[model samples]
Target chain A: MTDVDPIALAVFLFFFLLVTVLGFLAAKWRRGDTLDSLDEWGLGGRGFGTFIAWFLIGGDIYTAYTFIAVPALLYAGSVVGFFAVPYTIVLYPIIFIFLPRLWSVSHRHGYVTPADFIRGRFDSRPLALAVAVTGILATMPYIALQLVGIQVVLEVMGIGGAEDASWFVKDIPLFLAFAILAAYTYASGLRAPALIAFVKDTLIYLVIIVAVFYLPTQLGGWDSIFAAASDSFDAFNTENADAIAAGEVSGKGAIPPGAAHWAYASLALGSALALFMYPHSLTGVLATKNRSVIRRNAALLPAYSFLLGLLALLGFAAIAAGITVDNPQQAVPALFESQFPGWFAGIAFAAIAIGALVPAAIMSIAAANLWTRNVYKAFLKPDATPAQEAKQSKLMSLLVKFGALFFVLGLPLELAINLQLLGGVWILQTFPAIVFGLYTRWFHRHALFAGWAVGMIYGTWTAYNVPAVGDPDSHFGSPVATVPFLDIDIYIALTAFVFNVLVALAGTLLLNAMNVDGGGDLTSPDDYKADAGDVGVKDLPLDEMAPGEVAKGTP
Target chain B: MPDSTRGSRNTRPVWLLVALLLAVAIAVPLLVPLYDRATPTFLGFPFFYWFQFMLIPIASVLTYTAFKLSQAATRHDRAARGQKPPAGERGGVS
Candidate 1:
């Protein structure tokens, strides 16, 4: 790496080291009675108030990749990139509708993971296992995308690699970053991200506020910015006219036409449905102190969505400023580096890096919680103690981070993005089992499992067959596909989800009609209403009820 | 598990109104073609961009209103059941 700016690099490292120290010390910041329980390590003792939960969940949802990639997509594609805006706007209401119930039931049962709730709701170990496994699978690529975000920043800073640098040399900075992250996450579970999120989010907000207000002035005004962006897109369309005419690449414009409307809508809707189902998102929700915290935050968290809208405008600003990068993912960072002073650029870079760290820590913790509770404790050793579970979760968190590190370092970045796209498709399959299961037990566990299998297989196959423009022979290239009997292209995830629900409904009916024994429900309907400070329920013993007996007559 | 408080007061209206608000918040943006245009601009933002940004606060206020209504319903339920409302429920937006 040549001509690296020492001032910017030093400033970036200063904030990085500061957050690393805070991450390690956070283990003791809110020390619980004991660190031996999954409750303490995995969910921050299940005691985060509304304020902390707001920052933590906000930090988790709006990641470095989002800060970078959303604007990048806007810079590259135009209107379709704005799908993120509507999706995030709609997400809170969806979360408002269902998440409190999840928090209540999970709190009542002392559930550490979504799978635990599934197991309790459906009385099926396999269905819970499916939820847990899908969570991990979907999360790994997402974590890798975070690393890709970090890599973009590092590459922009000229610290990571050169054209012919060896892989080890190229990835040394990434490995170092991951090493520090894994160390703190191992020492302090969800607490690290919970604490670090404060710093990360503050930096993000400051950077965006400054960038949104300041950057536009530097490159004329908003009108010129939009005009420049429009010009660049027009130029790109002209350059790629053949591909556009052949329907290989999407047409470029600030607004999409009638034909592309379904693709945009389905993407926004499908992503909104899938966002909260991510294990890390739920982990943040479940960690809150009460049902009101969930409700209040659902109301309050749209502040980030507003901030995200401002951030997305930076894409047009980047085009107006004439910023260019080999990878469009680097557009935002490259814009900051080009426009801002050295120290401010350093702060912006630190914001992006810490952005990666917060979500990475939370995601690994969530994935670790899933693996420990569902796979290790459920299938491997049913009698594992809370202490044992805590220890296993700590270790598994490291493995999960390293696995994401390997994914970014070992594979092409395009593949990482593709895998995360597939992840979005895959995670939506669990909605029928988890989100639907929250409201009803009418869905047979075996049928839900079968539905999950069908959705997973069908979604993967359809995604694999869709060819990417310009990158011939690549599979899983786009999330949109034509409906089976109709000539319309829509999000494959929503289509597969429909198939999942229909199959699940049919199977539930047939199974019930055949007198198949639907497994016993472990949670009472009242458990869905229990909130923090509720008497008796919070202290319910893990095995207070027998395997199939619901808690009856409890008031 | 049948509690007297939940059954004593009617909360269906509050919940139905909240559901209606949320439905509108979610539906307006998903019907993409309606706002996918450039003519109507706010501070140089095209309709596609500004329309979604405007929905953020509208969604938030609707959610907050729903939260307050639900809280009010809970308080009403407690009073109807001849029980003292929890200390935390005594004051706030309501």
Candidate 2:
């Protein structure tokens, strides 16, 4: 590694400070008369129309993960990393089909988290609790993953953990970043992220466009880079493809056919399904003014996906440039520094660092909403006012930030990576019950519960058995490790989804045969199409049902 | 249900058409990979690598079609409710 450059680091740090100031000032920029309700704090008063929702959801979905990890995966795994490109492309149609209906229903009912909808949909406290806990659990690691992105950028810029430095000196960046993130998020709530998304997306686009054109020329050409990568792949296949085919790694260059193709498709589908389920993605959708905004954004957001395809190719550019990042995740940042002038490299670093801020803000806000609507009111304070709920959410947002900081600082990178894999397995189990529930309520409430249980069991068991090269301890290897028989990567989530469908169908049959009556729909068919109607308490009173009133079944 | 309609034929066809186009939009990606070989080159990148890039433009065309179709449906729905189209009919659908 080269000696640290203080000047470039200072410029990057200054840009981050500018963003923090902007974040704090956003409270006044979008100020409402009162910021005491969850609507104001969590969803930005639901005032965002098409323009802001486009940038907000774009910034949220195309994360530092897009800028950093996807390319790192490409550098490490060849064709497999390209899956992110297609997964994002396919995600639009999947979301377009169902997400607008979800937005219409949630906005009509004044719901904040998906869990709140579940509580009203199933009229079952236990199931809503499951959704809430899963959301919180799934979101924490993702928030931490953003910190990992920031960590890589800092390390490349010579600002993070030193080799011989004391623990405090080494870990100060993680603590300091979380401190700033938590403070602004607590102060401005969702408005902080929504406003900053404008800056984040502009910088990211600028950096990626420059890198795609600039680096290819410096590295001889796109032709040279591709030729080098292809030659490298060919040599590896000639020498070790047989060994790789026989389940042995004779050389480090070639990817086995099964390993390459399965990893590509698994990561693609797994990420697509998991993408919308994240609290941050939901926060972006919920903040929009109407259902059409959500649909139109989904239709247009592939512009960012095209950017991702460019970013992934930078991996091959890094290979051609002969750049070596100490951590593979720093591949993109290091590519910028080696190929560009110091000032532009500083700008690129700022893009990644600020990219972390938008998603981090949205994630903490979504988690806080979960705590407010589900745990705090459901158990702690059933009579809580809007003002009190907002207060609790602001505080809880800070706690979630610190909780994620601990994951980034305390654990090894490998273990932290495993937690994300575990998060995926657990999160994907929510799809059948949550995403599918948007379309049809045919799956009975009890049957939904049974489906969840079956899926969770199968997903976890298969994930626990996946093994990686030289590390059996790394169970459920990220999108690449597959279980036997199916010989597919342990997107245990998809496997779980299949199991969920089977059990749900069978359970429905058995319940009907036993003369068990399905609970009535909590929402009329027309409610799914309503955006504003009979708006009452934000938290629908759980105990207000008169006898024989239809208990909220899956609606 | 539509036999008693008074004016021109029902406009529900526009919505059904949009929904069918959405299904087709979704189906194209499912079909592309079946024929894509790993090593074949498209636009200097492998077929597997570049097919998704190609799909983006195709999807945008489909989205524009849906936008137009939904606009017509919304106008029909509004007319059925005995409401005039707003001063700005620029925004086709809700």
The candidate maximizing TM-score is 1
What ranges in model 2 sit over 4 Å off? A26-57, A162-177, A234-263, A385-391, A402-422, A480-485, A531-555, B1-19, B30-43, B74-94
lDDT of 1 by residue, A378-495 (tens): 8999999989987888787777777787656644453234445566888999999888888988899889999999998989899888877656676666778998998888889889
Cα-based lDDT for every prediction: 0.73, 0.64
How far does residue A406 in candidate 2 sit from its true spot (Å)? 5.6
Per-model interface RMSD values are 1.8, 3.8
Tens digit per residue, CA lDDT, model 1, B2-61: 233455567678678878888887888788878878878888877777887888898899
Candidate 2 accuracy as TM-score: 0.84
Top candidate by lDDT = 1
Clashes of each: 0, 1
